[model samples]
Target: MSASASEGPVECGGDEFKTDKNLRTSLSGLPSKIVAGSGFHGFKLNVKNTGDRAYQRVDFGVFAAQVDEEDYFIDTSHLTLQYKDPASGTWKAISLDETDEGAGYLGYTDVKAHESFSIDLRLAVDKSAPAGLGYAISIGMYADDEGNCVFSGDGSYYEFDILKAGTAPGDPGNAKPQGGKKPLPQHQPAGNTKIEPQGHLAQTGSSSALPAIALAGGAAVALGAGAVFVVRRRRNADSGTAA
Candidate 1:
């Protein structure tokens, strides 16, 4: 059932459905590096339902942290998430609902079996976001009211660096996939929107302390549930962000 305009979409993290094995997701288009205070940056999220069961609703959430340091959460207040409306072909800001653990979530409905849909997403970094490396942005897709998640394998999260304004990013030709995972194909931006070149910046100082729980792997802490599955990596305990 499609959610009414007034009712909005269903909130994720409920016990409504079971996890589906055929669902898969991938992200592309975002640069490996961005400048602090950069305006809306674009990316594409593709969701594929490879099985035979059509889903009534699907929910997703995103959270970020400074992975180079333990428990150093980024200030998400300066961040904004937006999606391109398929019907209107216009960009709309998603009204984010926070989880008890502080992740942000929203939902979409009516995904038929064996079908695929793509969402054009934009992430706006406000001027106040601290600049540094080891920043990881993670996403989780849930069905069954947040009970079942799409497989938390490759492509669920992306790691990058945020350079201070006026700094050059690393050469794109020299860029390599982090954690030995292959890079997903980049999505082309629509209109005149400019995407920064993909690359990493040299690490600087320490990151400011913010409230966040550390998940064992880079997976997002599901709202009202245990940690969502994602790729695991050994943390570089010696590396820390600038305060």
Candidate 2:
């Protein structure tokens, strides 16, 4: 959904927020490891900023491994990244792949101290995902320069149950309704039903009525003038005949 980056507690606004301060990077919450066939809707991890400084242009490592690799941890080669805004609770799908080292996933300080910021981790369901539920997901922060980065071995691993392969999310053969379905017509009763008369009031200050009224008034005035001119012409003709 949404996320926020700020200083101090997430609720308060104060002078404790600062830009130059050092930010504490942490991978506190990890999403439950998923199986190959089990369906998942919202997979989220929280990358919390525990320090006071505004963090920018930083790199974070994401690793996923099957449960079989318990002896030696293996990283998932294919990775996708997305972001959630803490303030608005909006989740935006990010198109960046694992190669996007310097872009995507950004956060800033919310207070004067710049101690607090949060990043929501997200992933979508893939058909080819692994089946066994036992897996590990981890991350580490790295500096832009080579060999300069923050690495905490196995930040936090969550054990999850995996579903069997080829399992669907919902009922089988049921298709979601699309917008192209036509609405059904309403059925009327066969008998003579006593229906209540529906009424509506004319809206005041309508522009359409004004033009019609002006046209009618102009026609009436023109007719009155023509009538007067005809009467005067008739009188003048009678006088000329009498003369």
Candidate 3:
């Protein structure tokens, strides 16, 4: 019960302030999976101002899987894409006014102590974006205080996989995970075969002609036999001339 034991650590105004134990800061209800090649899809981030006081300016980031290449904090030249005003409970799309370094920062005037606030982001997937299976998208948060700004403890990061397009809903194709090699072709080529077949000339008169010649010979033999029988009958009639 000494005075020193009774006094807990003092809270600093900047990013150095210890997070409120009861004050929960989290991001759920995300898209869970984003198709890699789909057009602009809406994504939401729920940021609850759980601290004792409202946050004046909090900087957040949206990053891909590879954080090494992502510069959401350093580069803010891109369009705002989305923002919500805490007072009106309405959301608005922020046009890119300037390409300055501070453009990436989403500034809020006052986020109430117990109330919750959220920002919906609409990020377009590059037309030729690679597919993702395990961990595709990542999100980070940093409280903007002057002194402790770039420090590590001021940030929170989350990782998620991108839902690949060209896949039927509830039907997950065996697409290679992001960062994986392409699958080999399954069918082998039919060697030396033409894709389009050439028209074959009918055997011309080769086969049909022989059969026709045989038929003509058969008819001649039949006519010769008939002539011989008629001659014999005419001779018999001559022998019986008087009768």
* Local distance difference test values of all predictions, in order: 0.41, 0.30, 0.30
Candidate 1 per-residue lDDT, tens place, 1-243, comes to: 321111212233323323344766566676777776767678776667777765443444344433322233333455577766565567765433232222333333344557766667787666666675433333333323322233224333455666676667665221123332222111111111111111212122211121111111222332111111122322232244221
Scored against the true structure, residue 111 in model 3 reaches a CA lDDT of: 36
Ranking by TM-score: 1, 3, 2
lDDT of candidate 3 over 10-80, digit per residue (tens): 11232233333322333343344555555654555545544465433233323322111222121112212
RMSD of each: 13.8, 36.1, 42.2
Model 3, C-alpha of 195: deviation from truth (Å): 63
Q: Which residue runs does candidate 1 get wrong by more than 4 Å?
A: 1-18, 64-71, 95-103, 133-155, 170-234, 237-243
User: What TM-score should be assigned to candidate 1?
Assistant: 0.56
User: For model 1, which pairs clash?
Assistant: 13-145, 14-145, 17-144, 205-241, 205-242, 206-241, 206-242, 206-243, 207-241, 207-242
Worst 10 residues of 2 by lDDT: 209-218
Candidate 2 vs. true structure, TM-score:
0.35
lDDT of 2: 0.30
Please give the lDDT score at residue 146 for candidate 1: 28
